[model samples]
Target: MKKSIKNLFYFCLPLLIIYVGLEIFLHSLDYEPKTKNEYLEKNKNNLEILILGASQTERAINPEFLDFNSINLAASSQGIYPNFCLFKYFAPKLPKLKIVVLGMPFNAPNTPKEYTSPIVNHLNLAFYNVNTFGRATMPQDYLLFHSNQDYFSSRIQNYFRDGNYSNLNKFGYDTTRFYGAYQAANYNIGKINKSEIHIENEHNSKAIHNNARYLKKIIRSCKERNIKVVLYSSPTHFLYNEMRDTNLVYERDSLVKNLMEEYENLYFFNDEDNSGFEADLFYNANHLNPIGAKKASSNLKTFISKIIDNPKSF
Candidate 1:
């Protein structure tokens, strides 16, 4: 019995040591948590404007381009449910948070959208609240890592690499852009998963219900805090919509407009038909490159300045 106990200790000791070492290293490194963690630790105190969305907003909106003190909390592949959780997490900490600019992609209103990347989904899943990512709306990202070892290993290796903050300005804008790359042929309309599309079609009411719930949660949270919430759709190249379903875009805009009417604090900027995008302005079909981002940012600042100047109009 004593020999067995000694063997067990030897087996567990290295694992325990490795765990501790990893924890210490994670604290020291600028990995997945670094950007958001930095905002919480350093910028929360003085910030008035906060941006949230998927990668498009991360790349498009330069906080420096805006006149207000701002930070972009958008992450790649993040959805609205995660945005709500992030608001809940940060609202208490940021006493001065006055305005929240949330990116609403055309597909954002569609319910039960499958998370594209396991790593991104898992990272955001860490912020999941049972109330937000309930059984019906949320995909089981936790189970994905078990089936996809390569992706799981890649996620870990990415942590050890020096984070790509080169494109990221201090205000959390990712300045990376596909300059002069007219690669429209490479861009395609976002495809719906056949299986999930079937499921959504069958349970149409459930998808709509969850969509309303998540969107309202974000608006309500910000309303409670007296923070103005902007439902912003950043510009894309005219080719961006070439492959998309116009009916679907119309529905999303209608829903957003209805919500804006319902909530006094909520504002919507569709920008669907407003066009000035040349081939050089786009990184791909769905996102603007640096040149486009600059022009879009200038226009946004003008719009926001007017709104901020006349708070009563909203």
Candidate 2:
């Protein structure tokens, strides 16, 4: 029995060494969570604007084009929960944070729970020490090496097999493929896989309530800090807008308008229509290409310039 035990221990030693090495390698990459957290920690005093949201915001807002000192925390599949968590974690540290820009497109009200992408929860906890998982974040979530085998393995493979270290720019904007989600959402959205972005065509009462709870938390946090909260709807192609359920759109618009009335610090800028962002500017039915991001950033600059201080003018 002693000889058998000794043989087993020797067999597992090399496997353990390889596992630890891979863990360190995966954590060392310039993922958005790690780099963005580092950036925010280093520049907490100078951040005037902190933009948070999912894919639509990722495609539209580029901080370099803005006049203020800003950082884009948006990424693909990031919902309101993660946005709120990130804001809550960093709000206290940012002395110069005047505004929080949230990317709230037409379907934003339908942001489902974090279980839709549990890896997001783990990513937040592992990198930024922010908890988007609420009560579901387990101690095991911290052990990314063991808990998320496929996700980490894919990242490892991507890093080694092809040298694809990261898709994020220095500003944390994901310079990756953005059209797949919007393209899949263009036709027969009902049949498209719901894993990527939130473009549900039907009215979901639960999703609306869940998302609203977090949205209100973010607004109230900003209210307490005396920071302005700007929630804007990014431009969507006419085809995408036309395909959406009109009633759902109306309900979402009404929800946002109602919240705006309730919260004095809350402001909304809607660019969901073709307002100069015609077919030529879109990468797909929802996301913008490089040219459109420039145009969108310029348009956003004009709007934000007007509302820098006066609420009445806006």
Q: What are the candidates' C-alpha RMSDs? A: 5.8, 4.1
For model 2, residues 108-187, the per-residue Cα lDDT tens digits are 78767552366667767888888777676676777666756887888877778878566666676665644654445564
TM-score of 2: 0.85
Local accuracy by lDDT, each model:
0.64, 0.77
The residue-level lDDT of candidate 1 at 221 comes to 83
Full-model lDDT, candidate 1: 0.64
- Would you list the clashing residue pairs of candidate 2? none
In candidate 2, position 241 carries an lDDT of 74
**RMSD (Cα, Å) of model 2:** 4.1
